[model samples]
Target: MKLKDSAIRPTAIAVQSPASTSTGTTAGTADRAADRTRSGVLLAALGVASFSLTFPATAWALEGLGPWSLVSCRMALGGLIAGICLLALRVRAPARRHWPALCAVAGGTCVGFPLLTTLALQTSTTSHAAVVVGLLPLTTAAYSSVRNRTRHSRTFWGAAVVGAAVVIAFAVQQSGGSPTGSDLYLFAALLVCAAGYAEGGQLAREMPGWQVIGWALVLCLPVAAVGAALALPAEPVHLTGHTIAGLLWLSAGSQFVGMWVWYRGMGAIGVARASQLQLAQPLLTLVWSVLLLGEHLTPAAPVAAVAVLVCIGVTQRARG
Candidate 1:
């Protein structure tokens, strides 16, 4: 009886109480959530960095290729890269139910944004066009809220508005204080691209992030092929080292790989939070414009940069 009692006491001491287990579980959950947030922020930042160079790259490409040829070739090249990746990995096609969203991704990012923005780049300088694209965060957030039925805090909204104002101010100053025809194309690009981004963010939740962009790229191949076929013959191309390099970056970096991590980050965080990071994109673009495109850097640029950073910090902190 003494031996049996001693063994039972030891067994009881080895077991944890329900309260202790619950507390441990909760702590683990919090740690994981924090890790995810950090990862998402880093990933989103990379995507923004990649995207920041896009306007400059487009400018470089435009030195040789016509707007239609540039857009069509870039899309086709990007799609081919993505399709090869999918084939190599043996990734399955997304469910038929997912096609509509994929089409939106294809139509907006692959077709609309590229075409409009390329056309705008013909008339607008990269610096001017970039600040216009600065509104993307707000547009994307609004689209996500409406489409996904998620709401953000007032803090988030405030920061987004402030950031947008700073960008618009810079754009207005750069453009000589009036709207132009190119502004129309840029604004249209923003709306369509926002739609693509919002849909891609949601789709990332259901599949691997790379796969989402990969499939979207693949799905648009037919359209891109047709565009390239028609546009290449009609439009002119004068390929140079700068143009080739720019085209490669546009196809590989901006279209596929950057967006792959972007969607992943959006899935880790929320679309709204992830997008707030893009407020920095214009300032980054400003730097690229100065370095790569030899565009002038104005005194107001430094001030706007600081303000946008503060706004990004505030938006990131808000729970929404």
Candidate 2:
């Protein structure tokens, strides 16, 4: 009986200990937040990995189809994919207030970026193009700041600038120290795509991430369909295995799946942090260029990759 009473007393004491209870609760909350951040980082990383394949795939696609045809068809196919999902789920139209942003997303992501990048690839090597597009994260972060009134720590901006400088130097060196015509297209792509990404990230916070992209796809379906119809008849088709595979990936993996997870990650973490993850994308794309396109890896690629990774770590540690 004494032993039982002692055990009960200890239990009562433990249950009444405010400090212990508070500590446990705080630890649990911190653990959950850390887990959520890790998950968000993982999702953003996956999207970047998916995107890294895009340039090589686009190069492969160009082998058998004209630029206009390839872009239009991929857009059309991506729209169809999202449309089917929306229909199956019976998702209603987005609120009227969201339409403008939806239109921006549709125009920038589905059409403008794809068309410009495809055009650029006609003149640029996959590696060189990857480096130029590496500026996308910086652009996206800036756009998010202005549009959403988000703030970041100086460490974050410093790291982001360092990463951007590395990529910019790589881009200039790869371009023989002058902006080529293709570089202009890529830069233009950055502006529109940054807008799309910032807006999509905002929309993701209000709705399901996949649904944000899905609705944008649906909104652009008519334009994509018409463009595809016109372009297919104009462009010659060779139907190589590479072209077919590339088109499928661009349409399904990048246009839909990548953006789906990307927006979700942005919603989880933030536009700024998630965008920083893309600093690794050019490095990944460089690898893909060698493996898939049989392109030579530049001497600067390894050095740039390492520098960018350090910057990524710093940005990740920075508080908003």
Candidate 3:
């Protein structure tokens, strides 16, 4: 997806006071920082794993449902689950003024990205799709830099260019083997998904990340429900045990727990840093696809993967 650079409209990070420093030895401060970093990495890894499963699950569900039906069902189920959890926790409703932003974020991130990606993966290999998605963080960083008009060193732009090249090369290699209309659609979906993610991260700072997502789902449910009802007639295949299991996993792991963890990490670490963790998502998805789906490994896969890793490292260093 082509990343859009929306103007930065002041996130919570901008107004946050600096962390308080207690009188401690230099080594103690270092140790504490290290601990926090490790914890963040652990949480981020969990979030990545949860997200990685989504593609395969969607693939499985596609066997039984149309893309819109699958998406609407997932959203409906996920929103219900999240609502129940939030209500149990007594989460307060956001002020009315926040509704528009919440709706925008929800539409872009929750509805548009997943719906399009599900449609794309209908004919695309999870491996190819995952590689294409590896550029998300760089796209997001580019969006942030552009929005803030933040000056970035030439090296940062160079790394982003290189990362994009690697992804394109990977795509070309996959395309040569078997390029289908669905594959092209999936590629387009990747761009859209990246844009939605970048926008969602930016908006998340203004509203509580979880609340932004949670409420967006709330506002979106009625519309999604209506869409699902209309699309139900086109859902030809009957749901199987495997499909049911996939739906369960998608709802519990990817939508509910994964989103919660991601929002928590974003709240603690700020969007840019939290987004860096997403660099691991595509790689992790590739691993899951191979192990679970019995997909053959392509020779170019590892090379492209390493290139993406290098790019992510460079991007992170640049941000620092």
lDDT, candidates in the order shown: 0.91, 0.92, 0.69
Model 3 stretches astray by more than 4 angstroms:
1-41, 177-180, 203-208
Worst 10 residues of 1 by lDDT: 4-13
Model 2 per-residue lDDT at 28: 100
Model 1, residue 307: C-alpha shift (Å): 0.4
Score candidate 3 by TM-score against the native.
0.80
**Model 1: per-residue lDDT, tens digit, 11-100?**
534778999999999999999999999999999999999999899999999989888888888888988999899889888888998889
How far does residue 244 in candidate 2 sit from its true spot (Å)? 0.6
> Which candidate leads the pack in TM-score?
1
Which candidate leads in lDDT? 2
Q: 284-320, model 3: which lDDT tens digit per residue?
A: 7878888878787777777877777787677656644
Candidate 1 wrongly placed segments (more than 4 Å): 1-12
Sort every candidate by lDDT, greatest first. Answer: 2, 1, 3
Q: By TM-score, is 1 or 3 better?
A: 1
